[model samples]
Target: MTASRISNTTGWLSFAGVVAFVVGVFNVMDGLVALFRNDYYQVTSQDILVFNFTAWGWIWLILGLAQIAIGAGLLAEQSWARTAGVAMAVLVAIGQLAFLRAFPVWSVLVIAMCVLLVYALTAHPRTRAYPEA
Candidate 1:
């Protein structure tokens, strides 16, 4: 890869790391709100897709923490982080969809970020060059 392309790829990866971290932080805040102030959300527990706010609160809180860890790994350029980030981003996007009714705008925004994160993680060129015959 050309030097400029390599640098651009690195930059995108770094941006993805930052995005993951920010998303995680948002999720943590959302979880806390759900846990402490259930009334903050528009929908009631019965209205949510699955479990009540309390259950979702714990779920988000745990997932957020995992995302934060993955973000750190990505920033450090760990190979596992790229794979984990893709998986986590997908999960987060799905979870956001499940959460759409509670907070429509926020869910959509997070889903968009997750999509960007996935693209950033996967769009880079392969580092290993195959032997040409």
Candidate 2:
């Protein structure tokens, strides 16, 4: 690849990495809150889509750590990170749906971010070739 093309790819990957890192941190905080203060959420345990607050807490905590590791791997330009990042983004978006009742706005925001993160990781800028004069 040309230098400019490589640069562009790197930039997009970097954006993905940073977003993954931020989202991971957010998940960690959410998990901690659920674990410690179940009442902090807007809904009761029964209202949750799948599991109770404590279970979700553990899920989010583990997912968050994995995301953080994926983010770092992406920044390092590891090939596995690209695939893992896409999977994680999708997983996080789906998880947020389960979490929507607890924090509607935050869950939606995270979903949006995950969408953008997926795009950044997957989409590549088109290149054009020109004939030499």
Candidate 3:
């Protein structure tokens, strides 16, 4: 007999994906503002990090797209979305950590969300909800 399916909310992975989706939406808005305004500049030194505004624009756009795709896929209980979502979230986290100066609050938030996303994706219930292809 098929094992009974549990609720998607039974674990952190699902929650993480949800968080990623929300954060992604926020990033999209932030990115669009930065891209359109042309007021994106900050102090820089050998120790501080900064992203090229133009390149960052594209990065934000691509990452946002991926985040949405992964979130939607997970919500739909798609297998690939689980892994992709986790991967993208991790990247976002690392990128944030590396560039914390440019976006202190946002970077920290993304990093925190990344950790939670990893936990959620690795959680047992979430794994079961999205079986491998």
TM-score to true structure, per model? 0.86, 0.89, 0.75
> What C-alpha lDDT does candidate 3 achieve relative to the native structure?
0.71
Q: Kindly report which residue stretches of model 3 are placed more than 4 angstroms away from their true locations once superposed.
A: 1-9, 40-50, 126-133
Q: Give the Cα lDDT of each candidate.
A: 0.89, 0.90, 0.71
Which one is best on TM-score?
2
Selected candidate, larger TM-score, 1 vs 3: 1
Q: At residue 106, what lDDT does model 3 achieve?
A: 77
lDDT of 3 by residue, 1-133 (tens): 9999775555465676687788688667656755776455363333335566555666776787778778777777778888888788888877667667766877787788778877888777524666779
Ranking by lDDT: 2, 1, 3
- Cand. 1 TM to true fold: 0.86
In what order do the candidates fall by TM-score, top score first? 2, 1, 3
Colliding residue pairs in candidate 3: 12-120, 13-120, 13-121
Give one digit per residue, the lDDT tens place, for model 2 in 1-133. Answer: 6555344346789999999999998899889999999989879999989999999999989989999999898888888999999999999999999999999998999999899999999988555587658
